[model samples]
Each structure stands twice: as C-alpha cells, then as structure tokens.
Target: MIENNNLVERQYEAKNNDLAEEQHEIKKNNFVVDTEERENAIEPILGSELEGLDPSNYPLITPSIELTIKNRFSSWKIAKYYLKEYGRQKGFATKRYRVEFHRNRTVKKRTLTCEKAGKYKPNKTKPIGQQRNKGSKRTDCKCHVNLSSSEHTHYVHITFIYPEHNHTINADNKRFTTAFKHFDKSIMAEIEHAVVYGYCDIHMIRNLLQLKFSDQLFLMQDLSNAIQKIKCDKKVNRSDASHLLKFLLNQQKKEPTIFVQPLINVDSNRLCSIFWMTANQILLWSHYFDVVLHDNISRTNKYNFPLSLFILVDSEGKSRLGAQAFLNNETQESYKWVLQQTLDATSSEPNVFITDMDPAMNAACKNIYENTYYLYCIWHLLQNLPKRLKSKLALIEKYPNTYEYLHNTLYPTQQSWACVFVNRIFTVGMQSTQCIESINALIYKEVSSSLSMINVVEAIDSRMQKEALKCKFYNMEI
Candidate 1:
C-alpha cells in the first residue's frame, strides 16, 4: 500500500524490487523519494504535519526513523517532544508564577526556590562566564543611600556686615520713652539677630544706614518706621524675639579648652593668633580690635576698637587661624600672662612671635621667652618705615645701596649683617607691620558681628575655616 501523509503530495514506494529498490523518508520534516524512475527531495511546510490536526497550527519536529510493523515511530519519543513544545508555549504563564512566588517568599523559602530552580544540569552547549556586576536599584546596594555634595565641599566662607550708623541703635534711657517700646526693641533686636544669624531684614536699619542692611527684605517700611511696623508683622513675635536676640548675642559661649601662659607676648604690632591642627583658633585667648567704637557704653565720644577678631582659614586652605585687632595700645601684661598660659597649655608652644618692631611687643616677647625666636613681621615693618621716612617704601628699590643692604640683611639667620639690620632695624621707614592690618580688616568685615568680646571670639573661629580655603586656592594658582 502507498500512503501520502505530508502537506506536499508524495507517493511512498514500499516495494517493487524488480524495477528498482525505492525508499521514502517522512521523519526529517522533509520528503525524500528514491523510486523506480527517479530520486527526488521536497521540504515539507514548516509545522504542517501534526498527528492531531488543528486548523490554526502545525507540528514542528524531526527524528531519524525506521517504520515499525504498525507504521509509526515509538510513543516515548512523541511524548518527550510534546513535553518540550508544551513548556515553550506556556513560558509567559510560568514566568508570571515564578515572579509572584519570589515576591511572596520568605528568606528561607527564597533560598530553597533559588537552589531548586538552578539545579538543572544545563546542556554542555550552555555558556559559562562571570556574572555581570549588578546595578544598585535591582540588587538594593547601599551605594546610592544618602549621596550628598556637602560631603565633598570644603568649608564655606560666610560673612555678615553690620550697619555702622543706625539712629535707632542708641536709646535715651532717661527720656519719656514715648515711641512704641516694642517697635524700638524689635528693631534693635533684629539688628542684633542679623549679626548672630549672619543675616538681617529690618526696614529701619536699612534706611538709617543709607545702605541695605537686610534692605526691603524686612517687614518694616523704613528704618525709622521699623519700630512701629515690627509690632504688626506676624513673623516677629514678642516672646520669641527676646529669646532669639539673647541667644545670638551669647554666640560661642561654650566651654573652651583652657590654656595657661607663663610667658605670653600680648603686645604685637599685629595679632598673636595661633593655628591649631585639631582644635579651633581660640580668639577669646587673644583680644580683638576693629574700625569703630561700641554704642553699648553711654559715653558717645570714647574711641574703642570693636576688637572684632576673626579666626578663619587663610587663602592657603590649611586650618583656620585667629586674627588680631587693628593697631591699639600695646596689649596688657595681664593679657600677655593669660595668652602665654593658653599657648603653653596647647600641644606645643608657638615659639616664634611675628610682629612689627613696636617697643612694647619687642619688650613683651623678650621678657616672655628666653629661647623662643621673634621674627619682625615683614609687612608691618614695611608699612611703618615709609611713614617715618615720609616717602614711599618703593623708593628703596630705586635707591640700590641702602635698599639692597636692607633687603639682604632681612635673612632667617643671625650670622650675617643683612640679618642684623633686617632683623633689628634703626629707621621707622624700614619697619613694616602690614599683615596685621589685613588680618584686622578681615576680622571686622568677615568675622566680627558686634563689639561683644564673647561674640568676637566665636566669629574668629568661624571665619578662619573660610579664609584657609581661600589661601589654599590662591597658593595652588601660584
């Protein structure tokens, strides 16, 4: 009997050996005929020959075959092929179920499932290589947690300048006090608050200064009217205003690491600020001086250096150093004693005192330490010399003989005469105390908020960090 089972019409020849030995193949998913007259090959339609016929689908499978007595392949081969094809068709459903299981599973359950799923002995053809590094989102790694730019940012230099001439500042205690007491107090308190918080927003302070002291940012209409307006402004509450002012005024009232000095040098043409690697520059250990007189005292005429000392990092980016007040009466002996005690108390004594050739400072350092070295502050000496000689300091460059002699003498060691004149000069024009003036200006502008001695010390510490960053960048450029 001849049979035609494929989508392509083909006749299978089972016998007829006298004419020619003939064979036909149906198991290669293709039809092959070697019949009495010819050998021909035909590829069958993909998935077209199915045992269970479906109008919409076909079977795609192949096997090496020899027809059995019943004219069929083994049932075991058919079953195995069906199982593989069925698993492939339901992949989406199986994947959905697996994801649900993983989500609901406990640690123990997940471990068991992961182990079981991975247990298959993969085909030798399966690839093997290192697994790719997992991304943080999928694997829940800690690398992304709390990432902030602040960690990398060096210290910032923040400065607040107070309005120098505000009329509302002074109060006539003996007068009627007719103006709204709350308004006056509020204005004053706001000014004090800006100094502490490093910001301001009072209207009257702005107008009175003729410059913006927190400017229109405040609720008040003008510096004079700020007294009346603060009462109506909801932001300025009476209870909180008093407390806030008090808190800011008492800035940096923390317990300081104590330093006791046996031989202290208080009288410097500039400041005597120490640079500590670990601790902050303790400006309280040194007195500060500034451009203006304090209004806190009743005497309106007395001239006093605000002593707004600042401790800030220099432009070099090292730790902050305490800045000194501007020129004033040489520092007091009691102050000297205290400073010496403080320096001695630190990790190591700051032995070299840098300052201009002011008699008081020179005498103070000489008396304080026998072995400690004192270098004449180059800047201070340069500044004072020109004033004494009544001509510009640059003239030294123009006049080579005295200028070269003076410049060469200013050496680090005492072995040469150049070291002697530069070290111990005879004229006022050659003596310069330049560094302290710059340091003093910084203290007033960037560090000191008010004339309060306590606040001055705090400002010094705060300002040093910023100044150091500046110094570091400047040096890097150089």
Candidate 2:
C-alpha cells in the first residue's frame, strides 16, 4: 500500500515538471515577439537619419536627423513628406499631435503622432456596483514628428521625432492613414477670393474646389468648416448692427457729401439711420428735376424695418436714387423724422412729391413741405380699388353709376393721379410712382429678407454701381 502511494506521487511530480517546461517555452516565444516589435519601432528612425548620408558613415545609433539642404519656406512640406513616407513603410495610422496657430490663423507649429490602437487594461480596480470605464485605449506609443518655425533662423525646424508605431500599419492604404492633411495654400487662397466676391454658396464652392483640384480628395464637411473659419476670421456677420453702423460711418467720413443722420430712440437709444448724397444730389435736384417719389417697402429686410426710398429724375431721364431711410415702424413720428432729415439735408422743398396714399406719409409731407404738391400714386390706389369695390359690386346692381360713385368717393379729385389735372411743367411726363417702384424691384432682385442690414446695404450699393456703369456705356454708345 505504501509503494502504491509513492508511485502515484512520482507520476504527479512528472506531470508538474512537463507543465513547467511548456510555460517556459511560451514565455520564451512572447519575449521574441516583444523584442521584434521594439526593433521595428527603432528601425524607421535610424533609416530616416541615414536616408541621404553615406552608407559607410552610418553610425551605430542616430540621436537626431540633420537636413543637408535647409529650406525655410518648405520646411513644413518636407516634414510632412518624411512622416508620410515613414507611415507608408511602417503600416500604422497617424494623426495630428499638437498644433499651434498664429494670430492670423496660419499654422505656426504642428506635430504628427501615431494613432495607437487596441484595448488597454488599467492598473486600478473598480469599486463595487460601478461599471468598468470604457476609456479611449490610445497607447503611449511616443511616436511623433514635430515641425516648428524659428523666427531667428527664418526657417521651419523638424525639431523632434520618435517614428515608431505600436499598432499594425495600414500599408495597403497609406494615403488614407496620413496625418494633418489639408488643402494646399493656393486652393485656400482661391476659396477666400471666391467668398469675398460673393460666391459664398457652399455647393458651388465645393464644385469649384473639385474643378480646381481634381487630383486631390477633400470631404464636403472639411470644405464647409474651412469656409466658416474664413468667414469668422473676416468678422463677416450680417446680424451685427454696430458693425453695420460703423461701416456706414466710415463711408460718410470718406465722402463728406454723403449725409447720414441717425434718429435715436429716447428710451432704448436704438438708432434709425437715413442716408443720402447731400452735396451734389441736392444741387442736381434744385437745378433739374423738382419731383420727389417716395415709397416704403416693408418685410423686405431681416430687421423687418420699413425701407423708404426717395427718388428723383436725372438729366438723362434715368430714375436716380436720391436718398434711403430705415424705420422701425410706419408711424407718423417715423415719417416726420425721415422727412425732416431730408429737408435739413437738401435745404430745398420739392415742387411735387409723389407717394402712395398712406395717411401718415401724406400728413408728414404736408406739414414739412407746405408748398409742395402731394400726388397719390395711381397704381397703388388702383391696387386697393379692387378690394374696396368688392362689397360695392352688389350695390352696382341697385345703382347703374355705383362704380363711378365709389371711384370719385375714394379719389375725391383728379389731381392726385389724373395727368390732365396735374401741372404739365412739374410732371416731366411722369404720372405715377413707377420710378420708385422700379427702384424697389431692382433692390429686391439683389437682396432678400434673410440678408443682414449690412449685406442689404452692400447689395444696394453694388446694384447702383452696376446700373451707373450700364448708363455710362449706353451714353457712350449714343
């Protein structure tokens, strides 16, 4: 019985020895794999250092790389090329590491680092009832290539590098794995130029980019972000009232004759600015056309402010823009303020002032320019005639002259619209407020209600300049 027990113990000891040998072999294999990985990491850095050097002069250990031909302008480009070539050879994904931006948003410094992939187990234990944290497992691969500008040298330096990747390199798709890729400077410049010239539509800009850089690949979102960044850098905001006012003030300062009057609200101190060319325009109006056409366009701007345009005829018989005013409301107070500003700017009351039959506008014109004849716009009166006569249509069956009765009741006299009753000398062959209406149509073509007040003003100015050029061309042809 003792011998049987000893035999069993001996057998168990032999099995334990066999298991120990297997474990030793497994650990030996693991050590080989780790050593190989470390060697792979260090090889690329050595290769980069010895790239352009004589093979005989290649040292046992290369601490840093030295560029034989120093380039100040293309330093970043050279660094990126080296990083890209290393990524291709090493077979790992790379990304931007640390980036520094200049005040004007140019890249002052940039670093490319390996994207370490795989799950990492933390050393700390989890508390009871707490879930395990699924934190990003990016390994400390210590792989990086840094490019920095040196002001003293006036050159970009490839300051540091660890050209080693812990993760498996994607050699098959090296282009897709490159880090810190961006549009070329030339492409970015073209995009900025397009935006400044009002070709700001994203889709159109995308098409332009594709056309210009056919070989290069770019994502739509990247292009969009670039555009937004450019606009933000330019400080272009349609909603900024203060900036708009400042822009107008600058214009006024540059041109002494450009009259700009800001009406301040007593309570809020909010402003409504009226603009006009006072110096030459007033003299032109006094000498040539004594007629003034006023029209109010509502809900045509982002602010919902009623834009009032004062127009006059030039010597060439073209409809000329005389003045522009913005109002928060179509009240008598607003109209009075606008009219009073006009009177102050021009210093001459118009002989004939034409407007739509708004009671506030009519009263303001009457009170401000007592000697001026206020003629109602026939087109506007006729537009309302249909709505007013809808109920009176039933009364037309009872009375044969019902239409004439309503017309006379609404119009009161013929001098308002009828050319026969108007003074021929003052009419200048103009019977209606068509000139002002045309100006409103021209403005609406260039601007929308969604546009900021500043953009609207810019569009108006652009349209005026275009029209003036057209007029000049026509006169030259004649």
Candidate 3:
C-alpha cells in the first residue's frame, strides 16, 4: 500500500508540472501576438497598390526602406538617410543618439533614436527670470534603431530595431518634423543649380522650388542655409581672390595670347590688383585703341572691389570691350598699374583717353600716356556740377547760383571736356564715357554686390562672350 501511494504522488507532481508548462507556452505566444498587433496598429494605412499583397509573403523592407532589422546599407550615410525617411513617413523626427568610431575614424556602430528620445532636464541652476517659456518636445521615447559594422566588412547594417514609439504618429504632423524637412539628392541638385545659374534671390528661389516641387515643404531660413552651403562648396578650398586668379590663369592656358597680370602686395603678400585681357579683346584693342573710354564700377563683388572696364569703338561704330581690371583702391598707383598693363599687352597707346572727372585716374593717364589727349566725360562732369555747388539746378535764371557755379567749373575744364576743344584729336565720334557706362550697366545686370570675386569674373566673362558673339554676327553682316 505504501509503494502504491508514493507512485500516485509522483504522477500528480508530474501532471502539475506539465499543466504549468502548457499555460506558460500559451501566455508567451499571446504576448508575441499582442506585440505584433500593436506594431500593425501603428502602421500607416497602405495604399490601393498594396491591397492584394499578402502580409506574410510581403518583403520585409519597402523600396523606400522601413525600420526593419538586418537591412544592410553600403555606408553609414545611407543607413542614417533611411532612418530619416522612415521617421518622415511615420510622422516623427529622428536624431543620432550614440556613435562608436574606430581608431581609424571609421564608424563601428551608431544608434539613431527619435528626436524626442531623451528627457529634457531643465537647468536647475538657472535663474528664475531666465527660464525659457517654450515647452519642450521631448517625451522620453525609447524607440530607436541600431547600426553595426564588423572589422571584415565595410557595409553598414541595421542590426536591431525597437520600432515602438510612445508618442502618437500623425501624418499631418509630419511636415512639422525636422526629418520631413530634409532635402534629397535631387532637391539638393536643384538648389545648387538655382544658386549657380538661376541668379535668383533666396525668396524667389524658395518660391520657384516650391512651385516645382509642389509636394515638398520649404522654409525660407532653410533655403538660405542651403544656398550658403552651396556657395561655400563652389569655392573648393580656395578663397574668392585666389579662385579668381586660378580661373584667369586657366583661361590664359587655353589661349596663349591672353594676358593675365596679378599684382601682389609685398608686405601682406595678398592680391591687390588684377588685369586680364583675352585674345579677342587684345585683337579688338589693337584695332580700336585710338580713342579709349575707361571707367570704374564699384560694389560689383562681395569685397566691394572696383571693376574697371576699357571700351573702344569698332569700325562699325559699335562699342567693344577692350580689357578689364579689378583694382584694390582708386589711388593713382593702382590706376597707373592698370594703364601700364593695357599698354604692355597691346604695345600701343590710345591717342585720346576718356574718363570721368577722377583726379587719380587723370594723373595716372598723364603719367603713362603723356602724349595722349586726356578728355573728360562731359555727361559725368555736368552731373557732378550741381553736387559740387551743393545745390540742384533748374533753369539758369531760376537758379543763378547754379549758373555761376557751372560757369566757374566749365571755364577751368573746357579744354578737357568741350567738344570744340577736343575736335583736334580723333575720337571715333565718341565724346563721353557712355560706352563704358553702358558696359557697367550690363555687368550690373549680371553681377551683384553679393557675388564672390570668382562669380563676378565669370559673370563679366559671360557678358563679354555675348557681346563678342553679337560683334561677330554684325561683322558677318557687314
């Protein structure tokens, strides 16, 4: 009887253990089902295209990439990009949480989490009046994705994912998230193209991009930031002055007859002035250098460097661009250097040099081309008459002070500007600096004060090319 009772007790103990095991297994399966159901509940509604797809046979990752584990990427950049896209799709922002780098500066591992992943701890030591009134966006979210790479592999792989977020994911709120504000490569290319060729301001650029990409969200500040970065990238390890010099040197290489002279300061070893003349410009100067018009355009570049243009009249009675210079200052020395460069390049001097009433330029012309007739632009002189007298001129009788002032100014400068006095010198029927002023206006249309030195050079070159084409066409017609 004792042996039978012992056997019964052992059987009962084994039966209880089996029942416990069965219950535990059921609970574990339920937990897994609950977790999966929760994940499915948070997923966005699929479009009609996915209506016939089977959930179990569906690809683990979508074409746009999903927050799924074991999804390998070629580099950490790609992995992070996918994470940002995933967050955008799910109506949340993502950020880098932690990164592990190897001694060689290569990435070993990285963790990306919801932007609201950590708690925003208020600075306890802050003064009461200095506390910010804006509420914090952080909610202590635990959702994150992990990436890893092994020593033998250079490929960045998504090793793990915790795809649950404590915050509600609203598609309408996606635009407010930083992740959705990110620009893709195509958008970046468009921005760069606009910056380079479109020549539009930031607001106009934003409007154009918004119109082109109707579905994309844009902020004025963000577009400005992007434009700044694009401009910086264009420099390519060179400053504006150095890049301009390099561009001119390259141009000279293409055409051996082209002349490029850069004046560097001995004390600072910095570029102070530069002059360039293309082969075609030299050819034009060789023919039309008898009556040269010179003037300066200020504020043509970011550095406010003064751009001087030389103009000459061709046989067809049309003005042609002869040469160009960028001077650091409007001093006599700078002007003299430019005139010397022009004379050296063409090996000829202008019979009549015309310019505005600039004393420095006049002195330089007198020093360099002593035999040349120095003529002043009558239009510029008349424009300055009122300013010199400190009053605007109406009819001479109405403003007698202006008449007297004009008489005084004109009597002294008659030989320099009076058409009758200058008739002795051949001027190609040109009297004023109107041709150079027109060229300056054309340059202003292409370049702005915000442009870099290199951009100013390129814009001026482009304008010169257009003029050259026009001249060639006219010559062909003639």
Candidate 4:
C-alpha cells in the first residue's frame, strides 16, 4: 500500500512539473512579442529625428529665420507638410493651422497665409431658446504664417510667422481646407473653352460642369468667381459704342458709301441713333429699289434698339438687304432720322413702300418721301381683326349687314394685300414683309440676345457672306 501511494505522488509531481514548463514557455513567447512591439514603436521616432536633424533639410517654424528666395517656389503641399510636421513636434494637431488668404488672378502677386486657429464665438447675442450660444472665446489669436512669391527670384518665401496658438487643436475634424478649394486643371480648361465659345453665363456653365463631371460638387459662387478670373485673364470686356464706331470706321474705309450717323444723346453724349449701308448695298438698292421695298423693325438685339431693316426684291425675285438702321426710340423723330439716312445712302427712293402699321413709320415716310407710294402690311392690319370681331360675334350673327360693313371697312379694297388687285407694274409677286421677317429669324438663330452691338454687326456680316456663297454656288452650277 505504501509503494502504490508513493508511485501516485511521483506521477502527480511529474504532471505538475510538465504544467510549469508549459507556462514558462508561454511566458517566454509573450516577452518576445512585447519587446518587438516596443522596438517597433520607438523606431519611427528615432528614424524621424535622425533623418530630420538638419534644420535646412525641412521648413523651419522659428519666426527669427529670415525669408529667403529658396522659399519662393514652395507650394501649398510643401507648406502644409511643413505645418503638419511642425505641429506634430509641438504636440498639436496639424489642422489647427487654417489657410486664411489665397491670392487669385485679380492680384498681381501670388500669396498664401494660414491662421493659427479657426474662428470662435461666445454667447454674445441674445439667446434664441433654452440653450445659449456657446463656443471657445479665444477670438483674437494672432498667430499666423504668411508665404509670398519673390518677384525677383520667382521663389516662394515665408514672409511672416506667428506660431503661438491659444485654443486646443481638434484632430478629429478631417474636413478639406479652404486653400485647396479649387477646380482641377481639366475643369478649368473646359471652363475656358466654354467661355471662349460664348457659353459664358454662370448658370449655363454650372449646368455644363454638372453634366461633364457629375461626381464632383461645384458651388455657383465659386464657378462665378472662377469665370471672372478667366475673363480678367482673357481681357474679355463688353463692347461699347466706341468699339462699334471703330468697326464702322474700318468698314467705311473699305466702302466709301458706308454711311454711319450717330445721334448723340445730349445728356450723356452717348450714341442714340446709328444708320449704315455699304457701297455695294447702295448699288443694289439703286437697281432694285423701284419694284418693292419692305421695311420692318426687329427687337431681338440686346440693346433693345429698334433695328430697322430695308429689303428690296432683286431681278431673280430674291430678297436682298438694302440698308440697316438702329434707332433709340420708335418716335417720329428717330424714324425720320433713320429714313433720311437711308435715302441719303441709296440716292434713290422706292416706288412702293410696304411696312407694318407703325404710326411713327407712316408719319416719317409721309414727311420724308412725299412722292413714294406707301402701302401698309395687311398682316399687321389683320392681326387686330380677330379681337375686334370676337367681342361683336353675336352682333355679326344678328346682322349680316354689320359683318359685311366691318369686313369692307377693315379690308377697304384688295389694293393692300390681294394679288388680283395688285399693280402688275410694281408687284414682283411680293405682297407681305415675309422677306425681312425671314432675315430676322435667320439673324436670331446665329446671334443670341446677350450679344453686344459689335457681335450683332459681325453676325449680320457673317449672314451676308453665307448668302453670297450660296449665290456663287448657284451661279457655278448654272
């Protein structure tokens, strides 16, 4: 019995020894892991210190260091990296330095500045509810860093530094900084193309950008500012009356009879009336002015001026532009000036004048061209017939004689619109002012309402050239 008990005790001791050895092995493995972790944590710090030991190797945070040309070429990325490293060394978050000023194209020089801390406020105003406004009261902290490009060296230099900060930095806020709020290069290129091609409106450009880059977010104000910058850079300003006058003068040099008369506003000394006709136009009018002359006003331009176009029928029965005038008002005085200018340019008067029922135009023609036969556009007279009859439809139904009287009074005779009663001598199968209306439609298609006076003139010139090309092609085929 004693031998068995001794054997059991020996077996228990051996099992206990085996368990102790296993625990010792586990503890040794744990110690190795902990030592490795400690070394790894210290390695980064040691490596950074040794690598950055030289002050010249990285940007200096000290304010005593004088700015040099070496800093002229420094970019925002470099400045940000420097700030982050300097902040890490000072035991503060990097984002505490907020970019405050960035020079756009409006300024002649390139500059960037970063404030030590963001804005802070207190419950200075009246409370709106149960809760009062609360925030850090450190509002006047003056720590900042200013960087500017050296004009002589073209290098970026640290012009100023005030690194001391009052508020604690928040590392959790990872929002993008305002300094980096800029369109990418590709986006700017697209904006330039759009602006150059006349899609310069801010709203239109924004929609275009949205379509092109749906993944990106663009604020309207930012896009406007960017467009303004581009305009400044390209020097694309609105064309004024002086520009128009200069262009006309150039045209007059080419065509001696290109008459331009500017009625100056006595109050502002600005152009109020302008009339022009090229020498070729004058020759064409002299040959074709007798058959039928169609005069109409188009109000599609940006200046809201009454654009008076005088058209004539050519030998081929095609509509040809004779003269154009821009009048400030539809008054008899402005119309007289425009008509007198047209007669003076062409040196001939049309036998038959067809025009809308504008009282001012009628009065002007009667006073200016006494011998010219005046004919009103029947379309204009008929436009009010429906409205006049609509209110008296029941009266017309009750009295057939009343309807006949109204129709006779309105039409009077077919001398105005009817082809059967037309004068075969003067009529080239033309009655209405459809020729001028079609010209206006074509002009409106190529020229926008926002175009300047110079652009309007250019668009008209382009249209005339296209017409000439079409004529040339027809002749070639003949």
Q: How high is the CA lDDT of each candidate model?
A: 0.32, 0.66, 0.76, 0.63
Quote model 4's TM-score: 0.48
Model 1 worst lDDT run, 10 consecutive residues: 107-116
Better of 1 and 4 by lDDT: 4
Off by over 4 Å in 2: 1-235, 278-284, 287-289, 391-393, 397-413, 423-425
Pairs with steric clashes in candidate 4 = 71-156, 71-157, 72-155, 72-156, 73-155, 73-156
Q: Alpha carbon lDDT of residue 301, candidate 1? A: 12
Write out the backbone clash pairs for model 2.
91-169, 91-170, 92-169
TM-score quality measure for candidate 3 = 0.49
Runs of candidate 3 with Cα error greater than 4 angstroms are 1-237, 388-412, 472-478
TM of each candidate vs. truth: 0.30, 0.49, 0.49, 0.48
Which scores greater on lDDT, model 2 or model 3?
3
User: What are the per-residue Cα lDDT tens digits for candidate 3 across 334-395?
Assistant: 99999999988999999888999898998898899988888899888878765656533455
List candidate 4 segments past 4 Å from native: 1-235, 295-299, 391-421
Per-candidate RMSD, Å: 29.6, 20.1, 18.0, 23.0
Worst 10 residues of 2 by lDDT: 62-71
Against the true structure, candidate 3 has what lDDT? Answer: 0.76
Worst 10 residues of 4 by lDDT: 171-180
Per-residue CA lDDT of model 2 for 1-478, tens digit only, reads 9999999999999999999999998898788777546644544332344455443332223133333222222345445555554564565655676889777666788877776633366665667457666676487777776677733222355666665566544444433433423665677787787666754444457678788777555554456556656765776564346745665676677667767777766788676654555455556666654888888887566788888888888777878777777787888878888888787887788888888888888778878988888788888878876665556556766454565655655557466667677755476677678878778887887567765666566555555555655675566546
